[model samples]
Target: SRHAQFAKPHSLWLNDPDSEQDTDEDDSDEVEQIDQDEIFDLIRSISDPEHRSMTLEQLAVVSAPQITFNSKVPDRVTVEFTPTVPHCGMSTFIGLSIRVRLLRSLPERYKIDIRVKPGSHESEHALNKQLNDKERVAAALENPALLEVLEQCLSTAGRST
Candidate 1:
């Protein structure tokens, strides 16, 4: 129910004995190929920040077509989401919830690229930069307050619509 413990667990990934074997099995022997539908299934049910009862899918903020897998690269997945309005303020939380869900579900080798659907938000560029940058993402995860809220949003990952 609460898989948020692994949100930014770099050290745990490295040090956990159980995870090391899991990682080896997941990382080397074979590559896990994911499709748009599978990726969508992973994130589509995330709880919307503004509406507790609505999933991102229910709100039409995200869809399977908005996700793309890089067949050429194989390890990169890009996900785009349209906010409720051009200037919707819950963009970061929604983006973070998507990223966190993927990070928790996907193998370590996959590089997730998350962004606001182009032109869907007034500050699309800035929001995209903050969401994609490793530094900013790590910084955000460090805040206890934000993490609590993010955990709440992500807590409904698969249990909802």
Candidate 2:
């Protein structure tokens, strides 16, 4: 069931020894580095709660270039996103969605910083603080109403992908 959630149709393995099909060599022993595109891929498909037909990518909320990872600070990633409108009431909701997406998709060691792009929202600092606050985020996820909305938005991510 887990595999079905994120699987592509193509198979990577080659059964016939004589076939010239080549598989990329495994480098699992090396440190797994996360990059901007990988982070973007993880959250880009999330649905906008107010706009069910559109994805966060389509609304220009999540951009690959806005995501960054520092190799020097392993297991940490920063993602700054813009709300569709400067005063969009859903800014906090969007931030929460991104936070939840990364928390579920990335490994336990990863420390995610989800923030509103500077000057994009009127309450950028406050929203960023709320989103990054472990206790606040946890509490928000526990609310049945917010959780329902989050689940609805997240459900579309899998189908759209």
Candidate 3:
């Protein structure tokens, strides 16, 4: 039986050597720092919850240009995503998917900040709040139904390019 529901989306691919990118951090022993393209690639293939056949990249919900990290604060990353519609009810789930993807793929030291693009969602502030709140995010994932759906959305992220 495939108990993917409890699995992290990036778990399967994390050990794949081909999936690893060479980073130019301070030293070889230093933790690898990922760039915008790497971040985009990690999430570009995430399957949209509603359009199962389409990816977040294909749906234009997430893009490399929308991902950023300040040079001085390389440990902090901010990803702004746009909902397909201002009233899209799945904004929170979409944000969750991004958060979970980054959380699983990036180094533990990386501070991932997932948010909705300004004016992109009617509840943008609330969405950002939920996504950034560790407690709320944990609570959301604790819900079996949401976790199952999240697993489904993330399962397709390992597609070979």
Tens-digit lDDT track of model 1 for 93-131: 678778877877787888999988888989899888878
C-alpha lDDT of all candidate models, in order: 0.71, 0.71, 0.73
Error of 2 at 77 (Å): 0.4
**Which lDDT tens digits does candidate 2 get at residues 52-105?**
678999999999999887669867888999988877767777888888877877
Give lDDT tens digits, candidate 3, residues 20-93: 22221211122486779888888888888777688999989999999999779988999999999887767777
Candidate 1 residue pairs in clash (backbone atoms < 3 Å)? none
TM-score for candidate 3, please give it.
0.79
- Of models 2 and 3, which has the larger TM-score? 3
How many clashing pairs does model 2 include?
A: 0
Deviation of model 3 at 57, angstroms:
0.3
The clash count for each model shown is 0, 0, 0
